[model samples]
Target chain A: MTDSIGFGHHQHACTTNNCTTPLAENIREQVQNHPCYSEQAHHYFARMHVAVAPACNIQCHYCNRKYDCANESRPGVVSELLTPDQAVKKVLVVSSEIPQMSVVGIAGPSDPLANPEKTFATFKELAEKAPDLKLCLSTNGLNLPQYVDQIAQYNINHVTITINCVDPVIGAKIYPWIFWQNRRIKGIKAAEILIEQQQKGLEMLLERQILVKVNSVMIPGINDQHLAEVSKIVKAKGAFLHNIMPLLAKPEHGTFYGLTGQRSPTDSELSALQDSCEGEMKMMRHCRQCRADAVGMLGEDRNQDFTLEKIESATVDYQAAMQKRITVQAQITAQMTEKKEQQPHYVQFIPLTSIKRGLTKQKFVHRPILMAVATKGDNLVNEHFGHAKEFLIYEASHTGVRFLRHVKTDLYCHGDDSCGEGETALQRTIHALTGCEVILCARIGYGPWEALVAAGIQPNNDHPYEPIEEAVEKVYKEMIIAGKLDEPLQQQLGA
Target chain B: MSFTINELCTNCWACEPLCPNQAIYEAKPHFLIDSRRCNECEGDYPDPQCASICPIEGAILDSSGQMLNPPGSLTGIPPEKMSMNKI
Candidate 1:
């Protein structure tokens, strides 16, 4: 697992006795530099989605399918819809400008499968023009089975299918209707056809050895309770990863769920569901639920920079860009290796039960606590609390400090005149950090400091610009000395 | 009542130029709809320009504090049926 941690550029480890060695190696190579497939690769590589597919075969309650929504960063929203030729040009321009660009995907202003001619045309052009790039697409699975041959012919290896539910009754609630056989079917009947098609498509893709990633939207009071079962079934069906994304239902986007006051799953609720499903399969925790026209690294969107008007006049030298990308990626891999070596060692505390059995006198228990650090990259606790857009979550215990995942949040301080009106943003940030016991940062304002303390999270700025793992270890020791480790997990989390 | 832009706005400038009444204005951390000048596009387009073009869900609200493009409006899926487990 450690060997798979760096930039995903490392060679695959094939055991001599394993029968599936070649297949395993092939899978590794497929996901190695693919940002969305491998979690570690996202930190180093970049991906771009071209919104060429504008028609969808099914209607999802959570999707609005709006264009020219530059501010919104959700799926199905794009600034400019592009033709197949325009999409190829945009990809070339973006790849040249952002040399780390490795994957070109068609995720939709609508379903890619719904617009097969346009989707495949773009892929065909890309395969001929930019042969070095990895090709992928996200689909609703309505037309996936039909397009499997075309997908393989285009050298597209990664396919994401949004599977909300297996049960038709539950599926009916999420999907109102699906267009099949030149007719629009509604309710349970519609859902049944969609579910059947999705399962068949998934199986067909797996049979073809195409890497399949299942995406499920966690709708609170709806599919949330049923996702664990979905995870188990998908994992059994041989899905490489399961990304359970939260339903982005805001009353404003004007989708069905949003209008009815249907609330999105809270960060804790979403994480809890993810943890439960994680035991069954690999859960994708770092997905940004990027826009259809998203460009750049995960959690960062650069679509505005590569709009149709902007890239129309641009010329791309694919050969030169590919050369630069190789050199840049090599340096990133080396840096990641050095960072791994510099990770600090921590003292693992013996379990309370074991201590009790051995000594029969010790009453205190050492509990593992989660710590969130605000960093502007370089793996350091150097970012101010207000300026942080995301926090790197870590678990510090007697077992030592271990990196977990990053939690994205709204900026609490927008700088200058925005500070006074950041009440809601601050609340959202605090909500996002619900499970963490400590917030390690360079600086925090008085309002947020008080809020953090009230929320049972210790806001610390004692170690400014210090390495994250080392600082986390220091804070863990301090907690131990302060006897805070003796408390239960719930108390530490302020639950 | 006029349409209002809430804190959820990322100030992406999508609605600023599309506003028929010229009510949506740029502000810190988000965009704000000037209530005094805002007419909710009553005499113009059937839908408020800000809410029609705004990407972030629930960012724009009507004078009665209701979202102009509430969740069910776009997909036409009823919200009551969405909570399947409850029923």
Candidate 2:
């Protein structure tokens, strides 16, 4: 899958017609690190998909209810389906363990939009907690219009819509039926509705400046020849990339097309189709047909290493406790914000007592997760990590940020006074913040940033001179989204 | 006319999805509200959703150069009374 087509240079529709809109640099940065979107980043960054969605609105000829959808080439396969709560916990574990995990997707055993509640719930949780990681959604686009606004609200930056064919004739041949509006419609009618909704959804997303990728499953003697046309339609509507996947036609899979003796396209045939489609749009040829619960880098599935049982056991009680705190914290923060003009002094912490504990012995003792802010007397995150010698540790929580302690650290780089011993200071600085999950600095060098991440701390260099509470609020909110305080460690079981 | 997000605007992403006209976009250093698309939520809502939800004071300014959400908008704490530091 050589991305010689250069998606980075291919801006969305706004770039055309001398558009009034300015190019979004931060949004480009958001996509720049996504492995699926950036060919270069694919070597370094990894992604994970949570199979929370378990229902489909439409059935395709190449799809088997028993297997995952035709969006990816994988046959009937999926890991354990998890509730939204369990999914967030699993994400936190995977994120902490695999630092390269940059995107969390809902490419499912079922349509994400079909189970909107479960899908959106997982997304909302991730949006607040793991805001740094990108959110990717792969939908059949049947219900895309209904959920576009909500999807935008959740800040889903990337979306993948599976449009096998733009032509209803070919679409009718591919899809057996679609359950739309209130009832199921079969044959060409279903294909028409699906196509109409998909195009509408694509336009809406483009209007919102959201990045879109179109995934088309090429079935030999079915829609394979029509894929080049599908690519053009989607590309014109501002789709960022087009992934033409090969049909995995096997009788054992029980797909309608497979049962009808539909032959799979040869590798050369699939590549030839992709090569032709490349001229129409940016073609993605490196797709590995990842499973619903696929994890790690593309072409690699490390889901077996992280199981549902292990995730549930590792994260259950910790998340239950944190969720309660976040709810209360949100209220307190709101009240505090309301009273800001009237009260000049900092507000005191209100002790919460509403968390009802179950008899199940808590296995892990909650570590006082700390976030270090680089400040210079104004209570702002205003200092560069390289220049700072002191850091303020805050007890980060959903309830609120509490001042824990201040630590003096070695400077990461040399000041005007002396040439610094860079590596020694870097190690010392990392060691000084051993217990911290995040270090908020105005600016940081790449060297120390990498070291901090390697030391299990996420270095946040975004907010410069922002209010400490605002930074703390952002961290605490992400803490809620992450659903876990820190990486899971061995602890005594509650007796 | 639509509002423009200046340098003071943080890329908090709080206002991007809130726009009814789907005008907000991410740019380096800050977000930019598309002038052509921004109707300021005239018919959709009584006030602009972007300015209403923005956390930063004076981050978004209207076409006429008036602050829709002026200082003391979010927290009600006056900007003058707040401590100022040069980052």
Candidate 3:
């Protein structure tokens, strides 16, 4: 059955040259095209989530499941819920339309395991119908132990378990109750049972050689500091990646934390936590905290384009679509190869003035710097500075330009009339770009250019329409040449 | 009169901080503008801040159910042409 579904063939199909760190060949192959698992792969591949499972056993303080929510883009929110048959149809339509779509994930409006029958039914249908697409699931782990066998039997290779805390005391604060063993369990006891099941399920999946990624919500006051311990434990237990996501506690979400004024972590705070946990495990920083019905590429959401109504009326030629998808993917791979070859080769440039001053003994070390690029996709820095809703952040060093994550920011310019009045918005944009030393955009007006420069962020319009990675590297090299790499960033901005 | 964010808003966080009156607040389906506090940037700016920066064509609306940044205003692409291209 697994062989018929085209499983295990991906074990040797690693094509992208983005993997800098060495990994087992099979492990590399599993994450090669998975957008959520690999940071670099997100640029070239796409994934869609089917909101098939609408039932959850665990009650998390930060989660309030909402259905038919089209406007908001967040976890546990979906514009439409689909039955197993409807889900299969949607996947076929989406895969046909989006050639880069590779993985189909059943991450809830609720937990997938809690709705086992529906979740497995969808997976079973997709495995049989669309044998080429990879299958994955995100679960709360309350019912994970019971479904591990079925998961492996269905060739579900990737599983993400949201494990916030290993200790039941800390877990109690996050999880108010968990429906287990035909009873509604509450408080620390409920947390204990949930924790035990999560550990056991993680171990069971690892034993079966299935890849597991652990996700933890970084609730500021609750279990914020304890996540490092959770990361250490999961890594020791063979979990491949640890994604420490910020708690989305907006008051309007109606979640317990949201109502009680539990604030979410700042971008800097989340980055700091991820950095601290980086030593213990491979930290995933590129997560978009997508909605259950999210579609298309990682940062861009194309859900409105493939609604159920659209798919129900559309017909799919699976064979032709699959062939076309292959051709498009090959083109993308070729483009990536060309871009890789075009990367600026790193060269150590010691300033002649420093050499004359006999400061040659001081090693001219080039530290990695973060740069934010304004782009409207197509892998180019083409978006205007004022028009960017989100900036794709990249870390450039002597090695190469690595995609870090996208930071959503308030727009700085409204229009010609509201030119100099975007002070509050400009301040927020600058604050969101806390650690970034440079901003690369297609064009910039005078007001924002002055504000950005005053905040110590060099706003450059030199790399218009240039490839993102190449532009970032060029900016890094320019900074190196100007001897500005060693100077400490201006502290006046309070970044 | 106050401005409103209709169903077309993608919750991109563009208009939330740009509101000078701090009238916009995050809601379940989308961001909402407080009618009482929303002066439509009358004294603050020449135009409503939220409508000017919104990327989506018909996302932000005026009190009378008219789009502030209507079709072809931001992208200069006609709505008729956009719909014809949709699959």
CAPRI docking class of candidate 3: incorrect
Highest DockQ, which number?
A: 1
Best-fitting candidate, measured by lDDT?
Answer: 3
Cα displacement (Å) at residue A484, model 2? 58
Question: A443 in model 1: Cα distance from truth in Å?
Answer: 5.6
| Tens-digit lDDT track of model 1 for B40-86 | 77877665666654545567888788876565443565656434312
Give the better candidate number (1 or 3) by TM-score.
1
DockQ for all models = 0.06, 0.01, 0.01
For the record, the alpha-carbon RMSD of candidate 3 to the native fold, in angstroms, is 15.8
**Candidate 2 lDDT, tens digit per residue, A1-495?**
111221321222222343322224655455655777754345346788898776666767766554433223362257476788888888888776666677899987678887788889999998877776789899999989999998999999899999898888888888766766444466789899999999999999889988999988889888877888888888777787788888876554555555556798865587578656666666665465677888886645678888877886674343544454445434533443353434332222222221213412333233446788886533468888888766766665423455444555632123423323344767877877877889999999888889899999999977888767567656655554354543233542322
Give the TM-scores of the predictions, in the order they appear. Answer: 0.74, 0.51, 0.74
Candidate 3 residue runs with Cα over 4 Å from true position: A1-21, A66-68, A334-369, A396-402, A410-428, A445-451, A488-495, B1-87
TM-score of chain B of each: 0.75, 0.87, 0.90
RMSD per candidate (Å) reads: 11.0, 28.8, 15.8
lDDT of 1 by residue, A1-495 (tens): 333432221111222332111126677667766788776667668999998876677778898644345567789888777889999999988998887788999998888987788899999999988887889999999888898988888889999999999999999889877767544567899899999999999999999888999999999999998999999899889997889999987655667777677899876688788767765766677688888999987757888877678888887787787788777766866775566566412223334354345433344546778899997654568899998888878777665565556777753234535343545677878877988999999999999999999988999999999877678878887777666777554565665
Instruction: Give lDDT tens digits, candidate 3, residues A1-495.
Output: 011011111111123342213456688677867889876567678999998876666678787543234556778888777889999999999999999988999998888987788899999989988887889999999888899999999999999999999999998888877766544566899899999999999999999999999999998989888998999899989998899999986545656676566899887788789767766666787798988999998877888898778999999998888788778877876675565445323222234344325434344555678899998766789999988878988777654566666897733233434433544667878988988989999999999999999988999999999877768877887777666765333432334
